[model samples]
Target: MQSLTNRQKRFLKSKAHHLNPIFQVGKQGVTDEMAKQINFALEARELIKVNVLRNADVDAKEAGELLQQKTGAELIQTIGHIVVLYKPSENEPTIQLP
Candidate 1:
């Protein structure tokens, strides 16, 4: 995945504002299975939110970075415990970044 520009990130942030977290990171942190699931979700939705529970071993930012590296998704933003991610689908993408 290529790096997103500020404009694109802002656009994605707006698109993601209405979205709820589809995945959660707990005490186990980021697992291989979770990364795979997130990757699949990104392929379908292109943009997604991930929540880091209070019981998570790592902070939301850390977990977001880990997920970013594992899934090749851009870490759009991390607000509170919610981590926003964006990745254009290789097949048919739904969201078009500006």
Candidate 2:
């Protein structure tokens, strides 16, 4: 996956700040189904946030990396149990590319 430009990363971070997570990774971490769902979400939204449940032993960064790998999404940021990812939709995106 291509890395987001610094400006794009900053813009995405600000845009995502107010939105709630669309998906949650629980004690099971990320299942194949969850990965598929994430990929689908990325195709639609380009940018998304995921919540990692407290019971999960995986660190937030690790979870972020795993999700990025599985979904071919960029790891925009990871704070606490929340992860932010971005992947340009195949079609033109409604969200501005920074």
Instruction: Choose the strongest candidate by lDDT.
Output: 1
Candidates' C-alpha lDDT: 0.94, 0.89
For model 1, give the 10-residue run with minimal summed lDDT. Answer: 89-98
For candidate 2, the 10 contiguous residues with the lowest summed lDDT are 89-98
- Candidate 2, after superposition: displacement of residue 40 in Å? 1.0
Please provide TM-scores, in order, for all candidate models, with all chains considered together: 0.97, 0.92
lDDT of 2 at 30: 81
Alpha-carbon RMSD, each predicted model: 0.6, 1.1
**Candidate 2 local lDDT, 1-51, one digit each (tens):** 667789989999998998889999888888889999999999998889999
Q: Where does candidate 1 clash, by residue pair?
A: none
TM-score of 2: 0.92
Q: Write the per-residue lDDT of candidate 1 for residues 1-98, one digit (tens) a residue.
A: 67888999999999999999999999999999999999999999999999999999999999999999999999999999999998999999888767
